[model samples]
Target: MTLHCLPSTDITELPATVSNSTENPETQTTAPAEKSAWKTLSGLLPFMAPYRGRVILAGSALLVAAAATLTIPTAFRFLIDRGFSLPANVATDASASATAMADSGIAAGQVNSVFLGLFAVALILALATALRYYCVSWLGDRITADLRQAVYSQVLRQDPVFFETLRTGEVQSRLSSDTTLIQSLIGSSISLGLRNSLLFVGALGLMIWTSPHLASIIVGLLVLVVVPIMVFGRRVRKLSKDSQDKLADTGALANETLNAMSTVQSYVRENMESDRYSQATNAAFDSAIRRNRNRSYLTALAITLIFGIIVFVLWLGAQAVIDGRMSPGLLTQFMLYAALVAGSTGALAEVLGDVQRAAGATERLLELLHAQPAIASGKQSLVASSTADVAGLGARVDFNNVNFSYPSRPGEQALEELSFTIEPGQTVALVGPSGAGKTTVLQLLLRFYDPRSGSISLDNSAIDSLKLNELREAIGFVSQDSVVFSDDVYANLRYGKPDATDEEVRQAASDAQALDFIERLPDGFNTYLGEKGVRLSGGQRQRLSIARALLKNPPLLLLDEATSALDAESERKVQMALERAMSGRTTLVIAHRLATIVNADRILVMDEGRIIESGNHQELLAGNGLYAKLASMQFNAAEFHPAVEAVRVANSPC
Candidate 1:
């Protein structure tokens, strides 16, 4: 997937705009506009597109169920009017026919036929209802699974900068909790809502057919009920959004603390962290309580209003029956239809609440799916000029008049006109004070971020013009903080070179002095390293990282304070391995210890952002420059001075 760069400014502003409301001080606010509910519902049609067949089947089943449900009241009407008490004229004829037919033995077959028909109707209704439940349930499961997968895939495709803008916990909450809510709406709520809607309409039609006078009263009451629902619907949506936000905040808090448990323990701030997490959880719990209260109130109000009107109308029908204006059977049927309509209205209200919540979740997801990356891919591919040309195959990096500032701190430039060169097959050591843009230079080389004003190139090709994956694949890196996964030693080493053979991995481990430790482990190469390799010593982890780099075997090697964490003995062993790895490769080493890079082909002393001095160890020492001063402060001149001098002599023309 090719990602176009979005302005960093725009990417930073998205979270602010995606939120629900600004009025509440507790929640982030987004711009508000009144859009149609149906329009919002229709937006989700894309997610449902793949499961159209299932939806159609479910819809058909629901229709069948609704039809059967609607017909049930009619059957009650038949049983009451015919089986219990027939009409005046029919009653007289039935009595005469029963007596005359009984004499001829004919009425028995007629009664049996009527009972058989009723039994068949009941059986059909039961079977249809069962089928409806099965089909709708299946549809819900299938559609929700598809939706979850789609959302997950979209999240995975996003660039690293996109993740930086949103909390990992928040994203995870949306995937699990938020998606589950939407799934409930899709799988059950929606089906029930539609079925109830059909029941409401069918019952209303039947009521009018049975007695239009009473139907008018029912319609008038429904209009009153709708007014309150519409008014409260907006509030329900806003609160639901608030509740979700608070829950996400709680999740973010917990996730952050758990990921950094070691740091929390080291600082002895466990109680402090726990208190903060508890506060977040309490806030979420409070919001949830308020949300549930509001929903319950809405439901209670709806049911009370609907049933109150229904009971009043039923009382009027009973009075009509007493006046002999309507049959008892007809009145019973009307009451049943009225109950159906009233029940459906209550269900519909609940569905409205769910739809509103799902809409909020959908909007949140859409905001992420539409988010853009900070870095754009270049138009042209970066190709090596030729295999024979060493400089052409590897990069001759020249940071010419470079100036940069972190996007987060636009006010301060981290690097200013930092010009330097790392020739092909030449190891250049960058020595600098803290915050001297050493790491920033490495970031630029990896194209994690572009310089504010300068060009970086590989061979003669601009770095930006190269495909990002291709550019990164050509460079091997070993940082001070090496990441180790909770996997076997062999798997961790092979992470750098997935296709590397077993022998190649063993050879790299041997070179890094990690093989001796691995052999001592219970399972040798298969020993599982605990999370972040906590079981291994800092030096052992560093050696594993070195082994990883050796396995990758990229043409250009970057060692960013790689040996800073190792003890003297481990450092010596790893340094030897590094020297072997750097041979025949373009190497850039960032070091604070002056002794490690004294044998480098060139050394660049950096302060703040610019290069302060550049020369070999002896030349810089002879000149008594910043490099010499740094060397004097960091290394034992009496012991390491001869080694520096020897390197200078060997390189000084034959």
Candidate 2:
């Protein structure tokens, strides 16, 4: 019912939760060796603090229930002693017993009053029990909801790097299974623990009052039972945590493989995945069995010791009654309370087991709650009224002596001393072989990763000074693999511009050349796109992405091989739409298809993270640099239009 992925530690019989943290190198957390497992639950206090009224109400109802349970023994004592005590000499025949009762002068009204009192106690116990359950269950549901929302909100705000170290499925397990354990603890376990604790203490007090000598002996003997339970308590808690970790492992594996079901099926790896999951599941079962066994042993020891002591105490009380040192009614009352104590003490052992299990669950959830994202938005975020009011208003983008390396591959520079400027309304294309750092340039501009040693500015001010949202507002980005959600066509198109009207949506799709295909669907624009747009062709998804960008209509546009996956015909149509939309906008294009950027205002060719050539199509050709080599590979000298244009433009120049 609830959700997020969490990291793991290995236990003796459980599959370890495996993940890579996606946190920025700066905000990564490390747990100290001395940190206790119980400390993890301390984070839950804040979530519960808001509902103190409900918690207090639940606690009060629990106490009342326990008290009502305790009073029942006294009522039973009254009823047995006065209301229905058999005459000592007349039990052999029914008529003789009735005559004996008549001769004993029994009070009819007294019998009714005692019966009524017992009924009142029973009624109070039932009502109190119901109220307690209702209140505690409600709290469990409420806190679980609040907890899920809080954890998810935190996770959503984390940087992508955080997920790089964690799996979504692992978090999913924590959210659903781990939180379910917490709910059980609050709704059933903790309430049971408290009520039983009250009964145990109350019954013990009454037992001492009835027979101090017997109560003292039992109390001393119970220390033996308590010691072993405490010893196994740590082990049980460890196993509980391990069981959860192993379950998370299975969830993560299933999520990972199932999401890539096509790839797995193609490779005929279904059996392999199934076996892996089975192994993980069996390992989890092993841990759970171990935990359950230990808890059972604990419960057995406590109940056996408690009942054994009570049985011995009952014999002593019988002896006292025979000697006339105690009345039969008093001995019966003591026995009832003794049984109550034994039962509640037995329950206390199991409640402690539940606490141990919940502690593990709490520790797991807390790990996520305590994690701080490396890239958090600053409080002084820029407020942009429109795209034009953003920090880099018209998108005169500048990268000044930028040097950077990805955190994952710190040894190799992703970009090195790269400086370039794209003037407003200039269509600049970055042409390079793979690993030329063309994509890195786009990432830096979008602030996906910050440059290590350079200042990036939009318009005139530094980009870091502006809010991430504000900086992103001025740019329309379309990547190679366009993401399409499982939603209607119109919804996907309006993702970038949520406020876009139906007319605006139609115009943007029309501009991106996607309107034709969309209109042909049975439901037209309302047709659903399946997961990752499985219902649509690659070209269609690309066009939808372009439509989304067009809807934004920002001053700056980024095209990262946006047409690379389309067929020739699809590419031609999408390219025409892109050209139409790119006009009058400052566009930075990353293209491997050399022909796409031949007519750009300028093309900067790069290699080894630094620009090697910068010029128009003809200017770079004359230089015979890296740009010319790339051009030659894509276009033959005999028919290359850029080469022809170069000569024509060259000869006509003054």
Q: Number of the top candidate by TM-score?
A: 2
List model 1 lDDT by residue over 1-654, tens digit each.
001111010111001112222123323223246465566656668867877777777777667667767776777776666655533443356577576546544456666776687677666656665666676667657765776677777777665455545677777766677666666667666776777788889989999999898889978887988888788887877777777777777777787889999899999999999899788778777876776677777777888898899899999999999999998889999998988888787877777777777777776665555555566677655555324134433456777788989875779888998877777788998887898888888888888888889888776677888888777777889998988999999999998899999999999999898999998988999999999998898889989998998898887889999998887778778888888878878899999877688778998888888888888777777778777777666544434444444544554577
For model 1, state the Cα shift of residue 102 in Å: 8.3
lDDT of 1 at 407: 70
Instruction: Point out where model 2 deviates above 4 Å.
Output: 1-38, 84-106, 379-393, 636-654
Tell me the deviation in Å of residue 285 in model 2: 2.7
Q: Quick one: best lDDT, which candidate?
A: 2
Candidate 2 has a TM-score of 0.87
Whole-model lDDT values for every prediction: 0.74, 0.76
TM-score of each: 0.85, 0.87
On residues 123-197, what C-alpha lDDT tens digit does candidate 2 reach at each position? 777777777788888888889899888888887767666776677877777788778877887777777777878
lDDT of 2 at 501: 97
Residue pairs whose backbone atoms clash in candidate 1: 21-29
